[model samples]
Target: MQQQAPKAYIIVSNDKNEIQKTSAYTAKTLSSIIKTCLGPRAMQKMVLTKINSIEMSNDGNSILREMDVNHPSARCLIELSRTQDEECGDGTTSVLIFASELLNQIVPHLKTLHPIKVCNILRKAKDICINHLNTIAMEAAESDLINIVTSSVATKLCCVLKLPIPELALRSVQLIKSSIDGRIDVKNDIKIEKILGNFDECEIIEGIILEKEIIHSQMRRSIENPKILILDMPLEYRKGESVTNMEFSNKNDFTRALEIEEEQIHKMCGYIVDTGADIVITEKGISDLALSILYEKQITAIRRIKKSDSNRISKATGATVLNRLEDASPKHLGEAGMFEYVKIGKEYFCKLSKCKNPKAISVILRGPTRDVLTEIERNFMDAVKVARNVLLNPKLVPGGGASEMSMALKLNNSNDKEEKIIFRECGVALKVIPSILSTNSGNGICLDVINELEKKQNKDGPYFGINGITGEISDMKNIVLEPLVVKTQCIKSGFEAVMQILRVDGIIESKSK
Candidate 1:
């Protein structure tokens, strides 16, 4: 009995064929879920989360994130959307669609060939497609940014916005770009606020907007050419870091302590007032004594502002945030041409605008409801990100599946039958984008649209693509354009995700007692 040892159990959960089928099935299922959410005619999904939160969106990434999937292949597809979003900020849906179609094309080959062979062929095809894409890319001019951004926003719900969203996005990017004299940071420089109203009221401001009101009612509600002072430290008296007991000799001692606190607050307020600042904004709290002093000096004060908001205020107004009252200086004060306290709906917002060289701005979005506003914000953000990509890369590609069709056609042109056979599947996968676009374009005949695009693409080159709106083959040079980097990243991300699932040969699980 002592010599007989227990045998270990090695459970083979799935073989190679079974694993590939499972992964392919998972990819197809997820892709089917997001395929209808591809183009302008795409339908939205109403997802109910575990916590009973309902999200209605056509965004592939958002929908996938709300889904609770335990399968490894499904997770890979979801992660592919996330990677596409993070890398290019657009094409989240397109990437997943491409991956699913690619997996479908190769699953047949996987039955006869090794997974490594398929992966090698896919890797080679992906590189070739990207190089071809680079050759087909056009240099993006300033005027082209509108088309690029418009193309990105057209597929979202915000396309119904009455305002010129593309121009607003470009203007915001340009405003920040001109002020910084360097590369643009869209997330940090541009702020989006969603308010309940009609879309006509949407506006883009040249400076940041504070969703806060004046701390003191007696303070000025508006100021002209105001000098702003930003503070990181509290204007109230300092308190001990830890609790300590103080034994007062009499009631007079307690009164004297209060007097000292008031004196400290007065000293702090005196420093701010001496700087001739028309507005005081602090990341930390301000005491009543300091508020009264600031109001008495005809200064507007907003306290308990978020640190990020304070930084934005400082950037917009050209002010340096100070932590100490003694360090206040006129040179450190920020200047703005106008400051107004306005009431919108039930909340009051402070707007600072007309800066000499503002580095930050806000886009106020007015929608019919919160959910609609949220979708609009998401769409607008994607537009902003597309604009940023164009600005940073300064390269464009024809949108509406033109690039994909062109690459697919080029990939298919081979003399050797073997090369054609191997790469043709890759080409077919690339064609999935245009196919899905055509299917979602409200066209009854998807195959006919794809056939027309293929013929036109072969003759007219890569600029020929299916018009997502009308499902007609048209030139996408002026109508729709995408950031070249986004298209490249989509192909690369999709290939990587497909290979990740395809290379998995088997699953092993140990039995738990």
Candidate 2:
């Protein structure tokens, strides 16, 4: 008997309704492949690239992006991941997981409808979903800032650990917010005095003080009256006379002029010392002769006064720098005179007399190792970025499990005439509600049991409501019943993913004939 070749399965339809088949099993197999990594207990994956390897997180977006999916639909999921990342910065996994599940739910219904009909329904559902989400979003309260912050942090922790300490999470949020609020820009040549042990003892001080060892052997161990000089100009002296082109006839004339210039620089320094100024702050560098005179007189000096720093110090201290060093004296120190220095850990804190703030806030992060510190820093920065957004926006809906439920329920009840076909094809789509509920319950039960044991073992508080919801618990609990939001986001994500996946359908090709 002659052998018969098997028929190819078509996965995509062209604009002219022509079916282009690849493999019939590809979409189904791809869907099942990602389903295993869906939930909280999902493991991490390590992906190696040409340059380096990235640690694989069970995060939906991360796993999808890391994988080399060849099928058209699977590739669409990757674009969906990118869209989620760009829009929310966080919800990448949720977008993909829900999207994959949505496709899975649609495949059976797709068997009954034309592919074009399925695509049309998807577009309509997307619009309905977006509208429903906007309505739910408006229901979010702007007054509940703390609840919003708590919810955001809890969501972050949920992705990292099944059972996270809510109180600790809240405390971390507060610390971050407080640190941002207390950030101070140090102005002037101030001292950072460390009061020994930790950051809590650090203080900021004004005025310049050099800790260098005294070079003069006979300089009174500590002069009772230390003369201070504040010069905001360069120590270099200009020629006494401006020589015209005719005046510069020979090198000898220039040499004598240079000598006289050197003498004037020495006289300037002598005058500064004579006026009892011990330290000088200048906007420019000091001449060699002037430096030598100050060194001989045991007068310490620092140059380079940044304009901003100078302005800030002037505003705070009520003292102006005299143009001529001869005029600078101790009497001109004004309110800026007092400064205290203390050593703390690796850095010094200089507390200026002018700053009247009661206390300085410092955030001390504790990590097991340097890498842990780096991770913590990265997480902190991410949180900070979100925090700023929340502060500016000040309105937020529920998140984590609650957010998932809200989206699901919103999609279910959404009523758009255009979306009727989608709802009809999927037939309320709530047939899978029981299964989702069952899975949600199962996941919750396992988490609850673990949390209960943890509470008993650790004697900590109850696990439920560890992080409170933005609105009433009832609202979040009824999320699955409100499928509009979930349906909308999912459909939108699906359409986008589908388009992107189709665009790159032939991305990988077989080289051999």
Candidate 3:
């Protein structure tokens, strides 16, 4: 017998059931892969890259970016998650989960109303949800922010950052906070570097780490109150761009030529030292002779530093990277309280410490395996980003799905004021969060537990959500909480994604030209 033809793509075409099934399958398809990476009990996904490399990560954003998702709806959800990760850092999974659930609920209602009408109603309901988020969110202290980050990191399916992650994250915020109105610039200020070692060994250094070694062994490995100079030129003989040939009539001429070159090298070193720069960072090579000369002068010189690193030093130390040494002066040098070469594993890193004020800092991550460290770094970033977002907004909301359930309770119970067409389904769909949390944690979602959360919706309970691990209703704020922005953005982005996909009436395929 021959293989039967495919089942005629029941939901792939345009219809009410089509929208519902396709959206549900797409959402479920995407969520099923990473939902296990949800709470503290989440699991890691070992994804195979196109190059045949295996990546074990629990980061939702990472998985979303790397996964081979083909459906338009799925890609929309993935992009929504990316925005969440970019703007907020954490909660990518939450946004996608909420979108999938919300779309899944809207699928059945497609038969009752036109997509345009449904979308219009959703926009209004979204405003209501956002207001609810802002109303319920409370201002949090620094300690509460740390707790939120720790809670987020601990639930990472890849590598739960134990203690070092939270400790280092808080320190990073503090260090990054030292600049400009004491605000943390997550993208620009905080930098992350990964190393091979135990994850627990990871720590946040107070300053930036440049992956460079001294140009000469004779140079001191440590310097205090180091004045730093950034150079973009080579100290070697300036062989003009075009080659030059010369004939010496006698050996004296050759000797004089060699002496002149040595004199130039010495003169360059003198000018550098004259600037009172204890550390000279060059973008180009430093000749052996120049290195020896600098070593004798007790100046710590690092050569062949990448352009990016040089710029970071400039930003961190207020040093100007001069193209010509003749332009150098005391004013051009940057000040660092301390500078030292730190040995981690087999590599030596230049550590810049003790700046009066630094606009940039670095976060160093260590792990036993490269694969594990890769994921750990991603999770570390997720935590760091969330921490930074909290600082910008500093408003906290109960996590563990309490916020969504509360939103649903209010919307579902709304009486007489607004139409129930679109808002009603969203209210019903909001429970997807806690329900999934309960199911993912291996606990059967008890209706009574959900009902209890809804029943207490009217009361002043900031801690109302299911304990995903135990399937019990408890104070979720103590175990897990999130930034108000994270909650608000999730709802806004999730519903908007659903509307975009739902409004697609059909896929028009043109004949290949």
Best by lDDT: 1
Worst 10 residues of 1 by lDDT: 5-14
lDDT of 3 at 421: 53
* Candidate 3 lDDT, 10-37, residue by residue in tens: 2255444575567678897887777777
Model 1, C-alpha of 489: deviation from truth (Å): 1.0
Query: How high is each candidate's TM-score?
Result: 0.91, 0.46, 0.87
For model 1, what is the alpha-carbon lDDT of residue 494? 87
Poorly placed runs, candidate 2 (over 4 Å): 1-76, 103-120, 138-144, 153-365, 394-421, 424-494, 499-513
lDDT of model 1, residue 230: 92
Residue 180 lDDT, candidate 1, scale 0-100: 41
What does each candidate score in C-alpha RMSD? 3.7, 12.7, 5.2
Considering only N, C-alpha and C atoms within 3 Å, which residue pairs clash in candidate 1?
none
Best by TM-score: 1
In every candidate, how many clashes are there?
A: 0, 39, 2
Q: What is the per-residue lDDT of model 2 for residues 1-513, given as tens digits with 9 covering 90 to 100?
A: 666665555444443222112322444455454544433333444555334654434345545665776665556566776665544334455455555555545555444555555666666655655664555443334445434433433334223632222233333333333244643222122222212242222222323333332333333333332444556778887533566453777879989887888988887887777666545556677776676777787766555655544444443444556777667655665243344443434444332343322121222334334433333333333334344444434444433233333334445554765455455433233222222322433344433433343333234221111112221122332231112233344446655554333223233333321
Cα lDDT for residue 186, model 1?
79
| CA RMSD (A), model 2 | 12.7
Can you tell me which runs of candidate 1 are displaced by over 4 Å? 1-14, 49-54, 161-163, 178-181, 248-252, 413-420, 508-513
